[model samples]
Target chain A: MKKIKYILLATIIATIWGCKPEEFGPIVGSEENFLKEMQGTWSLTKVTQVDQNAVSNGWPYKQLDITNIYPYKELVVSFQGDASGKPSTFTITPGNSPKIADLNSGNWSVDNTKAPTVITLTNNGQTSTLTLGSYANLKNGKFYLKREKKVNGKTILVYQYEFTKK
Target chain B: MKKLILSIIFILSATLAFAQVTLSPATFTAEDEVTITLDVTGTPLAGTQDVYIWIFSNSDLPAEIIKKDGLTNGQWTNSADAAKMTKTGTNIFTFKFTGTTLFGQSPAELINFGFLAKTKDGTKQTQDYKPYKFDPLVFVPMQFRVFPSKMDQTDMTTVYFHQDLATDQNLQRMFDVKVNLVFYNDATPVPAVVATRTALVTVKESNILYSYSFIPERLITLTAGTKLTKFTYQFTGSVKDANGANVPVAGPVTEVVYTPFN
Candidate 1:
C-alpha cells in the first residue's frame, strides 16, 4: 500500500510539471505606449516647404523655412484616445490659418504598432497619409510630420509640420 | 600719315565712349535702386568740388531737352542735397537713385531717361546728355528664367524652363529632361568653383513649364568666407539618332549672377 501511494504521488507531480507552459521575456507593448504618449494637445511651431524635384536631384537645399510666413502658430491639434488607450479621433483647430491637414477632424491610425513611420487620417472615406519624421521620440514633447502634395500620382511638393506638446 | 590720323581719331572716340556715365546694374527695371557712376576726366565737370545730377525724362517729352516736371532734385541752377554726387575716386563720382522715386511716376509711366553731371551752380557740365532705357516692367515669359531676379547665397532660388518659349525644335519636344549646374564663388580675386553636378530632376509645373529650385549654401559646401557669386546651368535631354538610338543633347548654357545680401 505504501509503494502504491508513492507511485501515484510521483505520477501526479510529473503530470503537473509536463502541463506547465514555457515562459519568455515580458511583452514590449510599444504600440500602447506610443498611443498613450500621443494622446494630448499639440501646438504648431514651424512649417517648411520642400521642393521634391530638388530633393530627388540630391540638391543641398530642398526645403524653404516658412514658419513665420503664415499664421501657423495659431493652429492647434489634438489626438484623442479611446478607453483602451488606442489611437482614435484627431482634430485640428486652424485659427486664421489654412487647414494644412485638409480635414478638420478624422479617424487616425498608424501603419504599424511596433514601428510607426506613417500616420493616416480618414474622413468620410477620404484618407490622407503623413510620413512621420525620423526624429519622433514621443516622450521628447516634439513631433514632426511630412505631407506630400501630389498631382496625378506624382509627388510635386512636400510640406513639413513641426508641433510642440502643449 | 592720313591713315595714322584716322587711327588716332578712332582711339580718341573709343576713349570718350569708355569715359561716359555708366550704370551699376546694366539692366534694371524702374523699381530698382540704381547707382550711376560718371568718369568726368575729359568732361567740363571734372575737378569740380561739388558735383550735382540733372536727370530728365527723355521719353515723355521727346521734343524737349530739359523737362524737369517730375524731377526729385532741386532746380538745375540750385541742385538739391539728394542730387549731390559722392566722389568715389579721382575723377569718378556716383549718384544713387530709384527711377520710380526720382521721377515720382509709376514703372509703367517711365521708359527712357537722360542724365548729366554738372557743377553745383550748373555753369560747368558734361558736354552731352547720357541716355538709358529701362527694362520692361511687364512679365514676358522666356525660354529660361530665374525667380526673384535677385538672389543671395542663403536664399532659395528657382530656375525655370518654358517649353513654349523654346526656340529649338528638339527642346520643345524633349522628354525626361534634367538640369546640369555648376557654382562659382567669384567674390574673391580668384574664383572658387564647385564640381559640376548633372542629373538634377525638374518638377513639372504645367504642360509646358518646369522648374528646379535650390539653395546655394545647401547644395554646395562653401569653404570659409566663400560667397556664391554666380552659377551656370543647362538643360539636357536625349534625342533619337539616325539609327533610332537615343543620343544626349543639351540646351544653351545659361549663367546667372547673385546679388549680395545686405
Candidate 2:
C-alpha cells in the first residue's frame, strides 16, 4: 500500500510537469520589414567617389570623400508607399547638388523585399538603377545607395550617397 | 725605410694620374658594353703588330690577385688570339668587352681592374698599368620607383609601378593599368593644368611590373623664373565589381620631389 501511494504521488508529479505550457521569446522582424522604414523624408548626409580600378587592384587612396566639396546637404528625398506597403513613388528635391538620380520624381520599385540590392526608378520610358550599398542601419535611420557610371560596358566610377532620416 | 715608403707613394700617385687608357662613355657599369682604348705612345709596346691586354684585379695583394681567363690562357709568354686587341689608330688599340664577362665575376666582386698593353713575348710592355672602375649597380623595387635616384628635371626620368608590390586590394586585381601624371611648378601650389596627361604604362615584367618614362622639360614648358618643384602621379586601371561590371580604378596620389636644373 505504501508503494502504491508513492507511485500515485510520482505519477501526479510527472503529469503536472508534462502539462506545462511551452514558452517562446519575443519575435524579431525580418530583413523585409526594413522596407517600411524607408517611408518619409531623408536628408543627404555625405557623398563619396570611389575609383573602382584602384579598389580592384588593391591600390590605396581609391576613395575620395567629397561630402564637403559639393552642396549635397541641401538635397532632400522622400519615399512614399501605398496602402499595401509596396514602393510607389520617390521625389527628389535637389537644390544645388548634382542630379544623382537625374529625375525629379519617379515611380520606384526594389529588386527584392527580403534583402533589397537595387532600387529602380522609372519615369516616362527612362529608367535608372541605384544600387543598394548598405541598409544595415535602416532601422536606426541611415541608408546608402551607389550610382555607377559605365563606358563601353565597363564601370568606371561609383558615386556613393548616404542619407539620414529627417 | 722612410725614403722607400715615400718613393712608393709617389709612384702610386703618378700611376693613378696617368691617362694611357680611355673608355668610351667614360662612366659605365660592369654590364655595359665598353670600348677599352690603349694609347701606347712612348711605351715599349708602341707600334707592336699584335698587342694583348694583361688585365688583373686586387693589385695591392699579390696573393689574392685575379686575372681574366684570356690573359691566363696566354701564359704571359704567347698571347692568346682572344687577348689580342684591334689596332684602331696609330699607336692606339681598342678591345670591346664587358667587365662582367671579361672578369668572370659580378660587378661588386670586381672592385677595380688595371691593365697594361704587352707583346706576344711579354718582354715589351707599358711602363705601368692603367686603372679603371665600374659604377655600383643599384636597383630597388617599390610600388613607385624612379630610375637614377639623383637627377635634374632635364634628365629622362622613368617612373615605375611594381604591381606585385601594390597593397590595395583593388590595385592588386586591376588590369590595363596606366599612369596619370601632373607637374607642379614653384609659381602655384596646385599641379600645372597643362602638364596633366594620361600615359600608357609599359610592362617591365609581364604582370609583375610596369613603367612610364618622361622628361619634365619635354612634358611641360616652364615660364621664366619658374621651376618644376614636384610631380604627382597615380596608377589607373579597370576592375570588375561584385555585380560583374567593369569599374575604373585609380591609386593614391604619390608625389616625387624634383631636382631642378642648376
Candidate 3:
C-alpha cells in the first residue's frame, strides 16, 4: 500500500509538471531574425474561392502579398497588386495618419510555437482583429505565413507564405 | 451497488449537459404588411415554466407591459387593447403590424423593434435582433385640408394646413412638416410663394385656437414678381406614442389663395 501511494504521488507530480501551460516570453527578436522569419515577401500562389457546390470555403482566399517594411516598432501593409494578382507590403507602425490614405496602424501580438505559430493584429480602435499563422522548416531554410485557407467540406488549411532568411 | 451508482451519476451528468432551450426560427422577416411568428420551447422544462413575450418598437431593451392575464398587479396589462401584445401562447407569439403603421409612409424609414421573454421566476430577457426598417414606397394617394377661408392680405398669409392621420393611429404629440406649393399666373402655373411657415394649433377650453408655429422657412426659392394662382403643399411628419406607434393626423391638403383686388 505504501508503494502504491508513492507511485500515485509521483504520477500526480508528473501530470502537474507536464500540464503546465506554455509561456511565450515578451516580444524579443532581432530585426534580422524577424526578416528571416517574415521577409522575402509572399504572394498568393494558390486560390480556391469556393468549394464544389460554390459554397464559401470559410477562408479569406483573396490574393494579397505581404511585404515586411520598417523595423520592430512599426509595420505597414500596402495593398498594391491588381484585383486578382497583386503585391502588397505590411509595415509596422505606432499610429494611424489623419489623411487615412498614407498609413494604417494597430496593436499586434505574436506567438511562437510548433509548426504553426500565430500573430494576432487588431485595428480600427479594436473593432477588427485578424490572426495570421506562420510555418517554418529550418532544415530547408524555408519559412512561410498563411495568407489564405484551403477548404474541404468543413476542414480548412489556410494559405501560407514562403520565405528565406536574409 | 457501486457500479449502479456510477451508472446513475453518468446518466445524470449527460442529461444536464444536453439540457438547453431550443428557439425555433431564430430569425424573422415581416414582409411589408405581414405578421411574424416566433415559436419557442424549453428543451427540459417546457410545461413547468411559462414564457411571456413582449414586443417593443424602436427599442432593443426589455420593457414590461401591465399584466392582464391576472398575473400581477400594477404591471402593464397585456390586454386586447394593447397593439403590441397580440396572440400570446404557451410557447408561441405573433406580432402583426402594417408597414405604414410601424413606420410612417416615407422613403428609407428605419424603425427599431425588439422582442422579450419572461420566465416563471420573473427572469426577463430581451432580443437584439437587427432593427427593422421600411423602404420608401411609391407615392401613396393622400389628401389634406386647410382651415379658415378668409385670407388677411395685411398680415403675410398664415395658412392652417391639416391632414387626417393614417389609419394606424399611433402618433406621439410631436410632428414635422414638408410642403410643395405651385402658384399660377392668370391660368398658367407660376411660382409666387418665396417663403413658407408652419405651426401646431391647440384649442383651449375657452374655444380659442392657439397657434404654436414652428420656424418659418423657405422650402423652395422663387424670383420676385412670380404670379400667384394655386398652391400645392405636401407635409410629412411623425408623432410617436408611449408605445412608439405613430399617431395619425387628420384632414385634406390645406390650401390658401391670393384673390387679386379689382
Candidate 4:
C-alpha cells in the first residue's frame, strides 16, 4: 500500500510537470554535425563586409551589389569531398579588374566551431580568409561571407558573397 | 481557516469595488509574461502627473487593504515601491512583467495579485482587480516559417506557431482554453504534426509566446524527389465552461497558407 502510494504521488508530480507549455522547440541537428554538412559546393549568394574602424569614425559601411559586380557573375567555387575534405578550386572568368586576371585554384576549409566561423581559402599562392555566421546560417540555403582590407590607408569593407548549396 | 477563506472570498467580491481596473490574461505561469494595463481613460488620471501602478502579492498587503483592494476605483496606496509600471497606450498605464522573474526561485503555484494605481500624492486612483483563476481561457498562435519556404525533398523547412495568451477580456471569463493545430500540404493527407518525428519543444525566446514547430520533408517523401509546391494550416481553439464542457470560440475557419518563397 505504501509503495502504491509513493508511485501514485510520483505519477501525479510527473503529470503536473508535463502540463506546462514549452516556449521553444528543439531545432533538429543544429551545430552538431559540422564537418559532415560541409560536403557540397556552395555558391556565393549574398555578402556584406564592413570596416569597424570606419564605422566608429561615423562613416557608413559600403554594401556591394553582387548582381552588378562583373567578376562575381562568372565565379564558381567548388568544394570537394576528397581525402583532405577541403575546397578544391575557385574558377572565375576574368572581368574588368586586373586582380581577377591572375587568380588561381585554392584549398578551403571552414572552422565552423569558432565564434564567427572562419572561411580560409588559398588562391594564387596567397591565402585569404573571411568569417561566416554559423553552419545554420550556411544551411539556410545561402552563403554569406565578408572581409575588411585597407586601401591607401583608408579602411574599407570588401563585402557580400553569399551562397546557397545546390 | 474557514473564516479566513470566507473573508478572502468576500474581499474579491464585486461589492467593495470602486473604479474599474482589469488585468487582461491574468492566468500566467512562471514561464509567462503578462501585459497588465491600467485603463484610466475617463477619470482624473487622464493627465499624466506622476500617477503610477505597482503590483504585489496578496500576502504583502494589509488585511484591511487586501479586503478593499478589490474595490473598483478604490483609493489605494502601495505598501511596496518595487516596480514602476510604464505608460503605454493613450490614457493607459501598461507594463509587461515576467512571471518567473517576479516570483523568483521559490514561487507559489498561483500568484494572487494586489495592485495599486494611484498618483504619488494619493490623489487619483483606480480599484484593485484580483484574478478569478490561473489557467487562461484563450491561446493565440503566432506563426512564422524558415527563409527558403520552398526546398528540395531532402532539405528541411520549419513551420512554427507560437502559442500566446489573448489579451482580450471576452476570452478571459471562460476556462480551460486550449488549441489544436493541423498542418497539411496542398493535395495530400500527410500530417505535418506527427509525434514520432516531431522536434521536442522546450523553451521560448521571449516569455510572451509558447512555440511549436514542424518539418515538411518528414511528412511525405517523393520517390523521384518531386518538388511539392504549397502547404497550409488550420487551427481551432476552445474554452471550457462551468460544467467542464468545451465551448468553441467563433472565428472564420480559414486555412492560412504559407507565403511563397522569397
In order, candidate lDDTs are 0.75, 0.72, 0.36, 0.45
The TM-scores, one per candidate, come to 0.51, 0.36, 0.21, 0.31
Descending-TM-score candidate ranking: 1, 2, 4, 3
Position B107, candidate 3: lDDT: 26
Cα lDDT tens digits, model 1, B69-144, are 3365687688788888899887888888878888877777777687777787788888545457777656555899
Which candidate number maximizes lDDT?
1
Give the DockQ-based CAPRI class for model 3.
incorrect
TM-score of 2: 0.36
Say which candidate scores most in TM-score.
Answer: 1
All candidates in order of DockQ, best leading:
4, 1, 2, 3
- Candidate 2 chain A minimal-lDDT segment of 10 residues: A25-34
Model 4 misplaced stretches (Cα beyond 4 Å): A1-37, A41-166, B1-27, B58-82, B103-108, B111-114, B132-262
> Which of candidates 1 and 3 reaches a greater TM-score?
1
lDDT of 4 by residue, B1-262 (tens): 9999999888776544523454433344433446676667656677664556644544344455322222122234432344455676676676565544554422344345556567755667666555423332122223432222223222223333333444444333322223333344334223243222222332243543333333344444444534443343322345766797877653223233332221
Kindly report which residue stretches of model 1 are placed more than 4 angstroms away from their true locations once superposed: A1-166, B1-27, B39-49, B58-78, B121-138, B148-150, B168-170, B174-176, B180-207, B229-232, B236-262
Of candidates 3 and 2, the better by TM-score: 2
- lDDT per residue (tens digit) for residues A123-153 in model 3: 5545222234333353345444443222222
Candidate DockQ values, in order, are: 0.02, 0.01, 0.00, 0.02
